[model samples]
Each structure stands twice: as C-alpha cells, then as structure tokens.
Target: MNTSKNRRLVILMYPRVREMDVASVNDIFATANTILPENRRYQIACLSTVDAPQLDGMYGMGLRTGPLYSTFRGEIDTLIVPGGMGNELTEPPEKLLKWMRKQGSSARRVGSICTGAWLLAQAGLLDGRRATTHWNQAHLLARDFPKVTVDPDPIWVKDGNIYTSAGATSGIDLSLALLEEDHGRAVALEVARQLVVFLCRPGNQAQFSVALKEQKTENTPLADLQIWMQEHLAEDLSVPSLAQKAAMSERNFQRVFTREIGTPPSQYVERIRIEAVRRKLERSTQSMEEIASACGYGSADVMGRSFSRQLSITPGEYRSRFRSSGIMAEV
Candidate 1:
C-alpha cells in the first residue's frame, strides 16, 4: 500500500495449474498478512505469464488474477511454483525455463509445490541437488533428471536454494514451513490455526496411501481380508494364517493378494504394522513394550530399535513432537 514497502512474494502458476496449489500458496500469504500487520507481512501477488483477467488451471478451472500481475523483475523476493500432471507433456519450453531462471536470479529463494519440481529442473535450478515431487511421479522425475537426486520419502525436500514437495495439498505444508522460516515457529503455528490446517508434517512421514497403494488387490474378497489383516496386526500374522483367515489356501491367497494389492501379504502386513506403531506412539499412553506387544513386536527394545531404523527418530520423541496438536494434515 506504500511506495517504501516491499510486497515481495511472486507465485508462478503453470499454464494449467493445480487449483489447490495456487489456493494454498495464496492462502498462506494472505493469512500471514492478516496475522502480522500489513507492515510486517510479505506482499503477495499472482504473477501469471500475462496481464490477464483469468487463467486456465488444470481440470478446465479458471483463476482470476489480482488487480495487476507482477513482473519477474528484481522487485520480487521469492518465487513459488506449483505443479500439475500436464508438466509431463515434455521437457519445459526453453523460453519458459529461461524466464523461470531469470526470475530466480534475484528472488531470495525458489521453491516448488509437488511436481512443480519438473519446471524447476527444466530451468536448471535443481541440478546436482536433492528434491522430491508427488510420490507417484518420483520415479519418472528420477529417470528423466539423472543429475537431480530424488527422495520419494519426504513430504518436502529443501536443498540449498531449491525446495520441492509431494502432491497437491502438501503445498500447504511447504507454505507453512516458509512462514515459519520467514517469521518464527509461533507465527507459523498461528498461520496454520487461521487456515484450520496442520502447522507442519515431518517430511519423512509416509503419505497414508504410501503403504495402502502397495497393498492394493483386485480380490473381491480383499475388503474382508484387509479388515482381517488389520484386526490381526497385534497377533503373529503369517501369510498362511491370513490365507486361512480369508478361507483360501496360501497359494490362492498369495495370487489373489498380489493381483489385488501388488505386494505379498507378509510385506503388506509390516507396513500396516508400522503405521499402527506410529499411531500408538502418538495418540496413546502406551509404553514401548505395550505398543510392541500390540503391534506384534516381541520386545519393547526391538520395537524401539525398529522405529529408529525406520523413522530416524525414537518413537517417544516422535510422539512428543507430532502427536495431535490439533493441526489437521491436508493430504
């Protein structure tokens, strides 16, 4: 509102943007301003390719721009990129990549929400750095960009100047983290509260579907089987027993299981077990030994050690940090 102030954030919308991606970024910036006074918050604007009234987003959606579109000139401090499935159309255009590269030159930082990392890589911004995209697209990104290290495990990846996130609404997590980085943990928490969303999610925490996807099965009997498998997690769940529980021979069970879920019953059980352990650690007062027993671990020490190996953090610590502070994960 004043000539002396810097309204420094520029969000780059793809020709066909993911609606939620743009919405999340704009929401965070808007909420940050409301939380901090206008004097303290960053200036936010929609910077599309042109001075236009509306832009086409993915799924034939339309997004109207603010009063004016900002240029990539040095005035902008940060550049945010959001992804869409269409980016796989081919390598990014030379002019587009060049413009992104040019924009990055003076911006304080550059980041992507989900597969927007594709655009960043096309601009040569992600070379020789670690990044992530939507988990489903991670492999394609890895195969195409041999120089960029891909870590499918993180909700968001930050390597020096570049940041990439997992699919869709995970952009909110990335945006909240940016607020935390810019202001403080308190400001970030408050911003999340206003948005009615999670303050932050540990990057390595698997998306809920990460485990479920591998366990997909076409067996019409799988609903009953999966319910049975979940019910028996605390027990010594073996393939033969699960097959028996499903009323099928082990050979039939395995075939039906693979066809339906894409993974063997034994491995799928372990994933479900891990997810249970995390929950028990978070929302319950169960001791390590108790949780271990409940999740079919023979000993508390073994369970704790397994948790460390899998999560790189002790189960107790994870609980202390992330156990339901009232923030809801958007994913």
Candidate 2:
C-alpha cells in the first residue's frame, strides 16, 4: 500500500480503544482494496495517540500502532477516530487535540466511530455540525458540547466533511458509505457481499434502540403484559384495555408500567410497533396497507404518520432505503 499510488487513510488510535470500532472500519476499506485497482486502493495506517509501539485495547487485546507524529507528510484523504473506554476519562492531551484540529483542515474527510465523536468535539471540529455517536453516550456529548447538534437516532451522520457513527458495527456502515462515495454503489455493494455484511444501511436509519428489551421489570403481570403486547399488536393497546388485561385499574397500570418499563405504556407501544413496522418494511414484500395492518397501525396513513413522527422518515422512503436489494428487485 504505497501512499503515492493509493489513497492514504489514517486511523488515530488510543489506549483502551474499542477494538471493534477500529477493526471493522479497517476491514471495510481493506476489503475494498482487494476489489479495486492498485491506484484506487486505500492505504491504511494505524497511528497511536501515545508514543507506544503497542497499545492494549479496551478488552485487553494487544494491537500494534505507529507513532502518531512520525508517520507521514502532506494531506490525508481520510482520518478516522475510533471510540473506546478512553473517552470516558478527562479530555485527551491538548497536543493530540491540536494535531487533530490541524488535520481536520488538511484531511479531505474526518470521521469518528462511536464515542470518538467526543475527541472531534473536544477539538471543536463538530461544534456547529450535526453529528451522532453511540446512543448510550449521545446525551453526554450533547450536554458537554452545547454548540454541536447531536442527533442520537441515526446510525451515522455526514454534516459537511465530518462524519460520525453509532456504536460497534456502525463504523462498518460508515466506511461502506464512504466507499460508495469514493467509488460507486456497485463497488461498495460487492465489497459488502464479499465481507458477508449488509450491502448498505442508509445513514438516516434509526439506531437499534433497546428501548423495551433492556428495561427492568420485576412485576410478573407487567412482564407478561409486555410480551403479550408484542404478540398482539393489532389488538387495542390503550391504557384502559391493557389495564383490564393486567387485572388492574387504569391508574395503577399506567404507574406500574411506567415505573417498571422506564417509559410510559403508550410510548413503549408506539416504539415496539414502529420496530415491527421497520422489520416488515426491510424484509417483507408486503404493501404499506398490509404492513400497517400487521403492525397494528389503523391504516397506511396512520403508519406513515407514526414513522414520520418517530423515525423522521416515511414508510415508503424507509422501505426504499432499507429494503434488502435482492428482495427489492423482486418487488
């Protein structure tokens, strides 16, 4: 991978970084290189934040890294920052931040994976740009950096040349998007097929939220009711109906459901219904009316409105963007 012929891509590494965030992004571009011509390939270099030949990743994995400053000269085509446990601590060294600030201008594009958005924020690169990070840390990023517009829904965001993505494999999604931008949709899709990953996930697709899955619930009735709600989406899920099914008064049911589930019953119902609708849109050949009926939406218009309100995308648009290509061709 010669810098003179290939596109130069630098990955900024730090101790305790999330290994997945780094490895997945690197793998996407590396896989692309195998398919692309020599002159069009990506020349990837991993540069360490600390002056160390090796760094221990967040999960105790050993990784070899090059010295940050000793690497190269001239403009970088792409500079990526990966998130990890390191970001939970205090701000990174001013020198590192300064270097990033400088490179942010020189690099054709700058991106952060997961919590790496924090490093970019600390350097003031994302101050006025719309960005996203892992859903878990998105609030902290927003609260800490009031100047940056933090959108927690999307799996990734591209506001100008600065890109940010959600947790874990979203880095791969971001890399694929960059690959498509550099080459074409066909090349990126082939790379994704070779890698055994999804061809491409649109940036605006909602992050896989663990809204109901991760919530704590100790009451047997509430737990049973939650499962029942999912299996019976088309049924009346209003507070009165659910309360009767739970053998409790409406007031008590609402209070207990909210306390146990970490969200009001109505809101939780909407979220799960939307999740169901999203799955159908992506995988099934069903029409909007069919999906709406199956997902318990009263009508296609109701489902579209729900999608718009919750995901900021209409059902038709979501299907077009996320429907599996093979499945899409059959339609």
Candidate 3:
C-alpha cells in the first residue's frame, strides 16, 4: 500500500461538550490508524478553547485538549465540532466562535455531531447548506438560523464539504462514513466490524426506529391497536378494521390516531409493514416474493414499490447494501 499521505483530523472540544460524541469519533479514527500502515494513518488531536491542562466534559470527565490557539494555524484536513448542553447558550463565547469560523473556512472538511450544528450555524458555516442535528434540537437550529436548510430525519447529511450527524451514536456512523470517503469501503467495513456497529448506515436512513415510532401513543386502545397492526401486517389494516379493534367509530379513531401517532392509520400500517420487510431483507436469504409475502406486502412487486416510494431504494438494492455478511454468500 502507498503510504505517502496522511490526514490531520482535529476535534474541537468545548466546556460541557458531549463526551460520547467526541470520544466515539476519536476512537474510530484511532482504530482506523491501527488498521492502516503507519504512513497512511490519521493524526488525531482534540483541541479546546479553554487554556487549561484538562477540559471538563458534559459528564464531568476530564479530556486532554490542547489550547485552541495551537490549532488556528495548523493544516486541518478535517475539523469536528461536538454538541452538548453548551450549545443552548444564546451567546456562545466570542473567541471560540471566531476560531471555529477561521478553522472551518480553511479546513478541507468541517463536520459536527448532534447539536454542534448550532455552533457551525452560529459561525455562518452552514448558511445555505443542508444540515441535520439531534432531532429534538433540529427545530431550534432551524428556528435560530433561517438561512440553513434543516433536515430532521436523516442519521447524517453531507452538503458539499460540511457534514452533520443526528445524535450521539450517529456520530460513530458519521465517522464510519468519513473513513469510507477517505480510504475505501473495505477499510470502513472492517472498522465498523471492529466497533460492532451495523455496517455503514446510509446517511438518509431514519434517525428514529420503526418500533419507537409505532408505539408513541399512551392511549391503551391505540397502543393495543398498534400491537395488533404489527402482528397482522398481512391482514387488511384499513381504517375500518383498525377502528373496530379500537372500539371507536372510524371517524373518531382516525382523528385520535392521527393526533396521537402523528400519522394516519393507513400510513402507519404501511410503514410497519415496510419496516418488517426491511428487516427480512437485511437478515434473510429468502426470495423477495417469500419475504414480501411473510411481511404482509403480498407480493415482491408491491414490496419493491413501497420500498422505492418510502425509502427511495428498491428492496433488492436495500438488501445488497445492508444485508449481513453471513447472508452475503447466499445472496
């Protein structure tokens, strides 16, 4: 392997920055270094604005972060800003914001984890760019910065050289993506395997889980109806059947379901069935027709269409991309 070039990755740590966000991404690059030859490895460093020997993280843990001034003139291949409670401040420290603006301007790539998007936006780095942050804080980011396009659904997003991830664990996913972009799929996959994470979740994958989305309501009847819907995904889950299960008139059930679940009954059922089909596609070697039938889609074509409409990918394509390695041989 040619080892002529190395990347300098700097993670910016601030008081109360989320420890997991910084540590997880750091471990990924550090592990990648172990996987590649010495000359091809990444030089990772953590820097903080505080002129102290140790920076205190959100959870009161001490992190070894060099003074922020040390990084202002360095060649930063990638500059990472981590999110934390500190992001909630209306007026962030002026010095830190200035450094971020300067470093972000010159860095080859600039990225953030979770609410770090706030810092990037504050620095005017995300204006006119598409970005995502922790789902809970996404609205705030958009509200605070109207010029930036906020996408709340994706696990991570990359618009040009700027990348932003959803939440804590999503930072690891973003790091894997960066590794894949810097090296190759083989190295990224190997690193993911070592980390025991699902291999390379596409940036567009939903940050929310299907199970959690389905069970969002507290109403006993609605909760039971959701469970029933999941169990009988192959059965007709139309408004009438679900309303009957809930013992409410169809009109009333539709109103309440939409209010509590945030989706129409029909749409929710379709999403559930689609989620079921996706799991089978990722884990099983069964033919598409069989898996589709088992997941209540009735036919492979129907499943494929649903996958395309909802996920923007075909069932076969999803399987190829996300299927476990153990099932790849059979595929």
Candidate 4:
C-alpha cells in the first residue's frame, strides 16, 4: 500500500495476544482501504517489545513485529493494543508499558481490545475515563484500577481520545466505529457488508447476547421459566405469574431467578422486552405503537421510557442510527 498520505495505525502486539482481536481490527481497516476509492488509507504496523523479535499470539500464530523503539519516531496517528492471556499477569513487561505511555500520549487516538484495557489502565491512560473490557474480565479490571470507570455492557466505548471494547469480535466493532469517525458512516457500512457482518453495531449495544444471558445457568426450572417468559412476553409476567409458571412460590422463584440469572426477575423481563423491541426497531419500520404493543410494552410512551432508561437512547433515535438501509427500503 502507498504510505504518502495514509494515516498511521500502529497495533501494539504482546506475547499471547488474542489472534482474533488483532486480526479482526486489522482486517476492518485493511478492507476499508480496499473498498474506498480514496488514495489515502490507514497504514497498519505491528510492534512488540525489543526483546521479543517475533510475537506469538494466543492461538500459536507468530507475527514478526518491529521493535518498540520504532514507535518513538512519533509517526503514529492511532494506536491499538490487543488483549489475551498475557493480560492476566499482575504486571506487564516494563518496557512495553513505557512504550504505551509514550505513544498513547502522542497518538491522535489510543484504544484497547478485550483485556487490553487492563494494559491501558496500567499505563495510566484510562484513569478516570469510561472504558470496558471483556465481560468476564471487567470486574477484575475495575478492581485492579479503581480510577477507571469500567462499564461491562457496551460492545465498545469512546471516552475522548481513548477507546475500549468488550471482547475479541468487539474489536471489529470498535475499529468500525473508528472508521466511521475517520471516513463516514457510508464507508463503514460498506466495510461491514463486505465483511458479511450485520451493519456496524452501535457502540452502546450490549456485548452480551440475549441467548447467552438466558442460558447463563444450568437450573432446569429457571431455564424453562425463561423460555416461557420469552414466548409469553406480551402476556402478564409479574412475580406471581412467573412463580406460578415455575411451580414455586413468588418469593422463592424471585430468589432463585435472581441468584441464577444475575438479575431480578422483573429486571430480567425488562431487558428481554427491550432486546425484543430493539430487534423490531432495527428490522421493521412498524410504528412505535405497533412495536411497543408487540414487544409487550403496552404503548409507545411506555417503551420510550424503557429505551431511555436502559439504552440512553430513544426508540426513534436507535432506529435512525442502527436500522439497516436495505431493510428500510424494503419496509
């Protein structure tokens, strides 16, 4: 690729970085360049510690990376750090941490994927900033770095010049957002299409899937109750109703559901309803009233409040930002 006008995007690699995290983000930018007619594209580079000439990723893939000293040249416009098993260590290599502190201070934008947020926190780049990491590691990150506010829900987050994402695939989501910022929504959407992903997911979208949340525990009664609730979303799902379905008293059912599902029964139902509403809003052009009714919110006004409370976006705004263009035309 031509380097003259291209923006420099350096991906900092470390031992045991997740291959998917690194490759997915790189592929998004690389693919964007191929699809865009513009001559200037993002120029990507892989860099590692001086002692580690060849970096080995989580999946045993070996990548030859430039020495950390190369980053001191200050040509980096964007810096991305990918995460993996290495982040579990209490202390990262001192040399790499120093390089991150320097590059992150000078780079136009700095970001991390998955557990990479931990590294950013260690480098003091994310202190007092809203950030996220893989859902499984979010608590640990917060515990390790009290100054950073860790939100485990978002697929990605942009706090000023810093960005962080939830997991491996979420790295692609963060990169697409960066592409949108650098290029435009049209270019990002085209890249998403070329990659055969659904249109770029909004950064605010939850990283956890509905299915994953519902199946988090192996309690057969609770599992069956969850299925019943999903199917009967439009019906009454109050504490008494759900308790009856689960063949338990209301108090007992509430306790078990909360313990297993990691959320109260009422809250769980609300999330399911919101997720259903979101799907309909993105896929169908139905009136808000119709969608609200179908999704068990009773009315558009009620659903509007739920959307604002849970997603910090109105139903109309969510549809405008996330509705697939092709689906919109068909609707």
Reference-based TM-score of each model = 0.76, 0.76, 0.78, 0.77
Find the number of clashing residue pairs for candidate 4: 0
> Model 2 lDDT vs. the true structure?
0.84
Off by over 4 Å in 4: 1-5, 51-53, 67-74, 88-90, 93-95, 217-267, 279-286, 305-331
Candidate 1 lDDT over residue span 227-327, tens digit each = 76677778768888888778889999888787778777777777788778876664467788889999988888887787787779888888887664322
Range of the 10 consecutive residues with the lowest summed lDDT in candidate 1: 322-331
**In model 1, what are the clashing residue pairs, if there are any?**
7-43, 215-261, 216-260, 216-261, 217-260, 217-261, 218-260
Q: State the C-alpha lDDT per candidate.
A: 0.75, 0.84, 0.82, 0.82
The reply for model 1, stretches above 4 Å from the true place, is: 1-7, 66-74, 90-99, 190-200, 207-210, 224-255, 278-287, 290-294, 305-331
Q: lDDT (0-100) at residue 23 of candidate 3?
A: 88
Better of 1 and 4 by lDDT: 4
- Per-candidate RMSD vs. true structure? 5.0, 4.9, 4.8, 4.9
Weakest 10 consecutive residues, lDDT, candidate 4? 322-331
Quality of model 3 by C-alpha lDDT: 0.82
lDDT by residue for model 4 (1-331), tens: 1234579898877778888987898899999989765667887887775456787778899877676654447578899988888685658768767877987788889999999888899999999899999999999888988999999998888898899998888888788778877776667777888888864566777897675666888899888888878888899988998899889999998899889988898988898999988877866779999988887887899999998999899999989887732222111
- Whose lDDT is higher: candidate 2's or candidate 4's? 2
Q: Return whichever of 1 and 3 wins on TM-score.
A: 3
Clashes of each: 7, 0, 0, 0
